[model samples]
Target chain A: MKLKDIIAALDAEVVSAEDLEKEISGGYCGDFLSFVMAQAPAGCAWFTVMSNHNVAAVAALTEVGVTILCEGVEPDEQLKAKAVGRGLDLIVTAKPVFEAVKALDL
Target chain B: MSSLHLEFDVAGNNFVSAGSASDEVKKTLKMLGVDPVAVRKVAIAMYEGEINMVIHAGGGKASVDIDTDKVKIVLADEGPGIPDISLAMKDGYSTAPDAIRDLGFGAGMGLPNMKKYTDEMHIDSTVGVGTTVTMVVNLR
Candidate 1:
């Protein structure tokens, strides 16, 4: 689904990169960087509650279409700017990580 | 043809920039028409190594050499080396401080995951000197 659709479906706010709405292949959720790196599928929307900047880095490296930041956690300003600079779609939701994933139908 | 070589300096202080090298390598592999699976494997493996460098080893340098049949990644770090490579290779043996964990890392899966995804893996480390990891993902 498009990133915009995911935002609407999950009731999330677009933290950055609103212009990019490329279709996502699937969803993968994890907090561990190594686990996500090894398991997360490319062209998918990665759901996590982690707000670190490396999350954006991993999304960029894995070519994930977007990142859904759950648990209502706001990323640092530097991270938000970095996500925008990297052309990564960052969405934040008030729901928990699992709820966001379920909302995406993953 | 000559091997396509690329190098990157991973900065320890910038967690956000850790995967830049891996991303660039992934793009290059894609453009080179490499197999998607192999590309993903290399990308993920190297990306994990890069993150480990930033999280545990202060910083490091990553060099990748791509050939027709395989991709070779050499990651060398000057930070404190692992005292026991075997223990560090375990899935849940992390020495990362709480700060690193707070950043969503330090779960101790980096080394194991890197080894799991690559076709061949080698590690050289000294307790106080440094560590070097060499990983290869063969494309057949």
Candidate 2:
């Protein structure tokens, strides 16, 4: 599924828009950075409440299609700027991690 | 392609620019047409090392030597060395303080993850002096 479609389905807010047409292969949820880096599949949509700037680095390294900040979490200014600079997508949603993931049809 | 070497100074406690070095190396590997799988391994392993440097060693020096067959990474830091490397290598063991945990790290997966993605790994450290980690990822 394309990122934009997932965003629409989840009612997510795009804070740092990259390639909305990018296809998300799947989803991985985690707050631990190294675990996410080691375990996440490339091009998957990452769901996390980690709003720090390191999230941007992990997403870029893992090549995640988009980052879905769940449970009303939002990226801080530094994180937002870093994601934008790296061409990584960042979106926010009020849904909890499980709910946000369940809403995905991909 | 000729062998290429890259080096970067990781500033300690600088969360803002923690992964910049690994990102640069990832982009360079991609541009060099390295295999996607190898690139991912190198990126993850190196990024983990970079974060470790920032968190544990109060910043460190990272150097990468990329040859046709493999990539060699060396991370050296002058922070208080590990007392028990075996313990440190444990999957869920970490010495990071609570502040680092709040930033979403300190789960004790950094070293294990680095070892997981690399073909060979070695560590040399002195308790009060420093620590150096060497890792290699084969491209073939």
Winner by TM-score: 2
**TM-score per candidate, in order?**
0.89, 0.97
Q: What's the lDDT for all of these models? A: 0.85, 0.91
**Over the true interface residues, superposed, what is the Cα RMSD of model 2?**
0.8
Q: How would you encode candidate 2's per-residue C-alpha lDDT over B50-131 as one tens digit per residue?
A: 8888988899999999999999999999989999999999999999999999999999999999999999999998998989
Model 2 error, position A96 (Å): 0.6
Query: What fraction of native interface contacts is shared by candidate 1?
Result: 0.75
DockQ of the candidate models in sequence = 0.64, 0.84
TM-score of chain B of each: 0.96, 0.98
Model 1 chain B lDDT-worst window of ten:
B12-21
lDDT of 1 by residue, A34-80 (tens): 67876788888888878877787777767677888888989888779
lDDT of 2 by residue, A15-92 (tens): 988678888888899999888987888989899999988898899888887899999888999899988887888999
